[model samples]
Target: MERPQQPIEHWLDLERDQLFLWVPVMLGLGVSAWLWLPDPQAWTSIMLALVAVALLALAADRGGRASRAVAIGCAGVAIGLGLIWAKAERVASPALTKPSAVQFEARVERIEMLAPRGIVRLRLVPIRMIDRPGRRSAAALPAQLRVNLPIADLPMGLSRGAVVQMGARLVPPPPPSVPGAYDFARVAWFDGIGATGRGFGPIELIAPGDASGGELRARLSMHVRAQVAGGPGAIAAALATGDQGAIPLDDAEAMRRAGLSHLLSVSGLHITAVVGIVMLVVLRLLSLSPWLALHWRLPLIAAGAGALAAIGYTILTGAEVPTVRSCVAALMVLLAVALGRAAMTLRLVATGAIIVLLCWPEALAGPSFQLSFAAVTAIIALHESPRVKAWFAARDEGWMPWLARQLASLLLTGIVVEAALSPIALYHFHKAGLYGSLANIVAIPLTTFLVMPAEALALLFDLVGLGTPFWWVVEQALRLVLAIAHAIAAAPGAVTALPAMPQGSFALIVLGGLWIALWRSAARLIGVVPLAIGAFWAVSTPPPDLLVTADGRHLALRTIDGEIALLRDRAGDYTRMMLAENGGFDGEPGLLSEHRFARCSRDLCIADRVIAGRQWRIVATRSAYLLPATDLIAACRGADIVVSERRLPLRCQPRWLRLDRPMLAQTGGVAITLATRQVVTVRQPDDRHPWRVPARAAQGSDNLCCSMQGLAKQRQL
Candidate 1:
């Protein structure tokens, strides 16, 4: 006989204890509202909206039924919106309008060494800027600037808190590479970085400031590198000091593809391992004395030690978003243990998320925050299942059975977490690991149990100059981990790449996942509907047939042979890669001039593309030079769209849209669908976010050749 499903009300009643799990979700919705809301509203308007929602919630609470819960949910959403809105206002700063070359003196706030690239990056607070005439100007600049100094030019004794004078070229934070791509400018805005540039000329050390914590971190990283050599040493330094800048690019990419990159960062797994080790040591020491064990509360004392260890470890690891979140969760667990309650649960995870959001509301949109919390939540939810709990419970069995059970449990947890994170991974990185579970089964235990402990001992013994043995162990273990990562990454179908997913589809998938993980009753199964629909929608969405960069000098299109064709064979690596990824092609693109679908000259290119069963012609500029009016007009006579890097004369008009330099400047980038004549832009015209650069009025230049030369120089940079 088949069992009948219960009503929504029955399920809700059965899962009443699970309501708190939705708090973080509600708060995240509010954050999303602030981030994705099309219309820009004033701070006053946001405050009023928050007040209205809070009052409405109060009124709803007075009513009967489940109105109170609804009211609370609404209030959470309002708080999220208000929190992010306030954060943006607090961090707002002016961005650079154009590229500038000038002399400047600034205090170094931080330093990061990129060993692979042989660059030393400095985060500086400007003291003043000097013009070409050697006069200090009052022109406003960003509060913080990130400058990259070539290793050869890096001055000796340059460290954090040092003030140095140097000449460099500065430019505004770059916009998105294509429509619907990640916005680096937005991230820069939140980080308070107004400009990014490269250093050149002589670097004169003005004042080498006193030693600071940053210097200690740098010294520790350098010492670790010196003690151990090669990729293993780099991994050890990353694990020990949270400085991943020195990691080799090849090794990092392999780890990323193998899904073991999380080990490179300080997060829940690392923190938990450290805390557990500390607690075990403390407990063992305290139990040595029977009198003290009976008189004192040993577990509570050990938990306090673990809590302090978690905090200290977080600080040592730079206190990044993921580390801080893990620290909060660990503290909550310790508190629960002190109060004699359940140490780990969904409620605790939700609580930790809420705390993190309250502190860094903008983190809601970042991959680190989302991925870390989502992975933990999914794992906790899985373990909370009654069937899973019973299966892992103790039983009278052989050591082989126990080992098999542990292995199965690890595999199951990995698969569930991977499934929950796939949509998010695809949405952000355009790729997700296919064999992450298989790789992590070996990697996690190796890193957590063998490598970290050995590295910690090595660091401890280094104070007495007797750390060689421990360092050797650390090196050998890490070498094995790296070997496994490389092997897994090279395996067939180790990764699956997809095109950018629509925001709406991503939202549905996330919401469905939340519902399934948060609820305990049959109603949770209902989430499968939206999950399936979102996946189908994501895969079936048609990619743009024609795409143009914001600068308008570069363009890519899908040809009749279903291959991606680029305007220039020597286009920037990042630009070409993004264009192919956005167009749903995982491989290289051919030059449009070489393809049968397009003909190109030094200044002009006309590409023929068929999208959605309709043929369309796209005419675009291939260089920064302006073509003769007659030639341009005659060539683009009946073109569907004209994308020119130089401003097109009014006499030359396309049938549909004309995206010139000015238009592209306002739009950021463009993606077009030929069949429906639909167009998508990187940014909306009405977006009044503080980070957005206002469109500049077009000005006439007396010498077009000079302007073109400057553009060429900028492109080279």
Candidate 2:
């Protein structure tokens, strides 16, 4: 006589152990809330009140089971918010404002050699910075500076902790190039890099510090490059030292396009390989002694050895966030083995993510954190599927069948991971690698089994001058990896570019994916609803119809042909590239001056286009010279929008919007959509944060005629 399980009880039983998997998701939501809030302080009281409610719910003994789960989720979110706020406050430092030529004495903290650029980048902490020519009081220096110098100009004795004096021109970390675009300034702020500069005059080494691990890493990179040469060498050096700066831009681009860029970063795959190798070698050595194997815990000893190796390698390779995360995951695996527990599970991934989020909440805003976690989570979910488990457990009749099964599993994993990460790629990079999964099927195995091991062996042999043989193997393996990358990247339909989507859509997609991955039973399939809706929303959102650069020197407008046309054909490469990416256009931008619908002149330009069933007229200034007062007024009077780098005369006003110098200075850059009459600025009016510089006071407007008269009087004086 056995009791039958109720339907609800069975469902609950299925998900009982899976509940913890949602903790990281809750924490990430909180982090996202903090980051996305325009004014964190304004929402502070509300968030804390919610936390209080959650706590009371938890403390109460008479509530529904659902209430307890909700309480746990709220607590996780509150902790995440508190963590990020504390980290931001703790790392707060002065940031440089404006540009200036400065001379300073500083201690070098780190160095990166950019071989293709022929420059050396140094992270420095300044002792004192005096303005150039000694004509003004010393300017307030940032907590840290990143400066680039010509390779030839680098002092021979320069090394980490070395004190040096140099003259350089520095500028504050730049803001976003467009509204809702990537914010490098915020990234720099979190990293404690307040400014960036280029060396000008001579750099004199005042004190050469003692030998350090950073010096060792640099020497190793140089030695590897010298031994291997070219792009392959750069990749090998990156594998060895985690210094990816030396990789040629072309090679890096190819790798990114081919979806093998993860190989360049030391993460789970690399760490797992390193740990497995160390454990196997150590275990084999211990087993060689029969008495020791019988008397001692050889597995435990090997696990300890592997843990040490993982930590040592993590530190040696600069300890990037992904690498550190992998190291933690690997250590946890080793700990599980030592304790005789099952290792790989959703819990392990969730635990690692929670630990990382706790320590570096700022990492939540970065692609590395999102992409890595998404990939891992997807892979784990795929393998843990009941159907997949059953298939894997089925008897293998022969070696060929087993091999086929393995290949199929790898392909399936790759596809799942690519699917999980595509939304993120589109949101951050505005593009997704369509062929990444296919490329990774070959690339991951090749990199994990052959390339990394060969590189490690080559490095070991280099110590005694016997590394040439292994180095050849390393070079050939890396060459094959590059060949795969370039071939895949050159293929048609290798990438899919999408218009940037709103944060809400992206969040919905992520939540849907998490729901599917973190749960079991029939309800998990319900996630498809939100997932499909989010995908549709992201794809259907229209791009901005107008974009203006921060300096107001470049403008792009959507034409009747649906092509993005730039005002200047000679715009800088970076700006042009970003605009194209944002617009989801692959071709070079056609010049608006050359477009059929626009009329251009020496001092002014006028363009007209129909958007959302309405014709909009746009006017822009082309020259610094003041236009005729009547001409300026006439051009703007009927226009829907006016864009000018110079402040317009009081008589010149647009019906809808006017973007002039003062406004551009405050907003940073702007993107507008004609259909909804919506406007977005790189720096929103309420984006007063720790790193943002305050906008200057505006000057009073004057009529063109009055300005001309004043200019004439000054000339007469």
| Whole-model lDDT per candidate | 0.82, 0.82
TM-score per model over all chains: 0.91, 0.92
The Cα error of candidate 1 at residue 36, in Å, is 1.1
lDDT of 2 by residue, 401-432 (tens): 99898889888888999999899999988888
Candidate 1 residue runs with Cα over 4 Å from true position: 1-11, 40-65, 134-138, 559-563, 693-717
Tens digits of per-residue lDDT, candidate 1, 357-469, equal: 99999889988888998998999999999989999988999999999999999999999999988888888887788999888999999999988888888888889998999
Model 2 clashing-pair count: 0
Collision pairs in model 1: none
TM-score of 2: 0.92
Candidate 2: deviation at residue 52, Å? 3.3
Worst 10 residues of 2 by lDDT: 694-703
